[model samples]
Target: MPELTMVQAVNHALRDEMRADDEVVVLGEDVGLNGGVFRCTADLFEEFGEDRVIDTPLSESGIIGAAIGMAMYGLRPVPEIQFSDFIWPAFDQITSELAKMRYRSAGQFTCPLVIRTPYGGGIRGGHYHSQSPEAYFTHTPGLVVVVPSDPYDAKGLLRSAIQSEDPVLFLEPKRIYRSPKMEVPDDDYTVEIGKAAVRREGTDFTITCYGAMVPVALEACKKAAEKGWEGEVLDLRTLLPLDTDALIDSVTKTGRMLVLQEAPKFCGYGSELCAIVAEKAIDVLEAPIKRVAGFDVPFPYTLEHVYMPHADRVLRGIEEMMDY
Candidate 1:
């Protein structure tokens, strides 16, 4: 095992997978010669050559449309959308065609496609580049939504996504791409999709979060620990087929819940988690479920800190829930 950043871990996964399987091809704008805007695909072009590591046009729709065609024919295509904000142009192709391919064909075909894109705020990208539109795709039935919080999960979950038969939207949090280095195995491994990880265990309350917010939640839990309050932090790695059992168990044990996310509060992914607890574990709740999230406004370039939730904001929510 060797220490690697999230970006390096993702690159290693891509390189390893492409070596292990010839059908695994990477296609996206600047992914080849540029090694991707974030350099997640660094050196892949030189190692695998043009056919495997392809540099695509600027059109997001074309990138995904071509990948879907490749998937239909038996090649596992991993298309990279430079940013999640730019993915809307390919939304129709993903939701209508990529997602429904298997069901529509009555099992005749499957889209083993992984659409990887950098998402969320932390780098001060304005409205055009920092949006978190995961809620839109999570609502779709056929797609799998995955967000990795650290380098370890980044590599493992990506391997699993590439191997999955269903179309996967692998959202990488750009904020912690280079930080939080961790020891990751050189050999292949897969983190099962649809499962959440309990990052911290505590008895007082449960804090549910994922992606960029995972670090915030962990930091908040640390602050609470110093105040003689224990907080359990649950990282919801896979969003679509949520780990409902783990969520309910944590809430049931702690008797209080606070959902954290970088997205807006209204109809955000946190709302779904809150609703799930309210529906299934209402009897175990000692206090009403609360959420600390981004403001219901466009992601601002200057006011990025004010718009997104921080450890203090999360700690305040925890205190309120504890006092209630």
Candidate 2:
């Protein structure tokens, strides 16, 4: 019933969950008094107080490791990594310990932890602050990777991630953290995980993307429409356990496909989508699957525009697909 930015919606979700659930606790660097570097946790510290909302040291591994421990014991912990580029320090803790808990214990225990982090380039954050590393966690066995494109999905998907019985990697696209505003319901609701939303419908082709690239894909679709190329755009709210059914269904009707991501082209989430289409929906394809993604290089500070896949670049890829 109100319009809010992605970051504001995230704050709403966190506050609502904390109020409804006593076990829900939030902790990270500068998350309490500072209210997070991006201020997504703004006012939360004052509302929830110190015990429920805590500020930890600058150790990424300690933040995640402690969250895992808290989840293992009876608390539902939501730990923020500040930035995704800094998440690698906790890779072992996430992959080896948090991800393997339920599987290793044969369901004797579960890690209901939400590892929240701001990710992606476009804010001139350069290499250290802006990077899309969702692919790494998607490859892990016992983790659910979620990326919401807009305010509504951000609130809903985050609520689902917090309530899920399994470990979740919640990557918020920092690039569009506060720009666009969309209507989000005030009442509590959860968007189902592992489902993709069809943003724009078309019959010529389909553009599959997630996170900040969702807006890029939509813009590409609009550009293509001017040329009479009606392309469907699929916003994959969840990356891991991808909604293969939605992808195949759209490709089946459109007969052309393009997968996009802000991460590097090689081994990125786009690659996985291409592979799935080739394996399951190739027969319906009118053209080879195309991938429009960030180049296989470190994100450049000066040339941030070139490092991100924008509408123009995506339109070029669509042209190539059409020509091929």
Which candidate leads in lDDT? 1
Backbone clashes in model 1: 0
TM-score quality measure for candidate 1: 0.99
Q: What is the C-alpha lDDT of each candidate?
A: 0.94, 0.93
Query: Model 2 segments beyond 4 Å from truth?
Result: none
Which lDDT tens digits does candidate 1 get at residues 1-324? 799999999999999999999999999999998999999999999999999999987999999999999999999999999999999999999999988999999989889999999999989899978989999998888999999999999999999999999999999999999998999999888899999999999999999999989999999999999999999999999998899999999999999999999998899988999888888889999998888999999899999989989999999999999889
Q: At residue 156, what lDDT does model 1 achieve?
A: 96
| Candidate 2 residue pairs in clash (backbone atoms < 3 Å) | none
> How displaced is residue 106 in candidate 1, in Å?
1.0
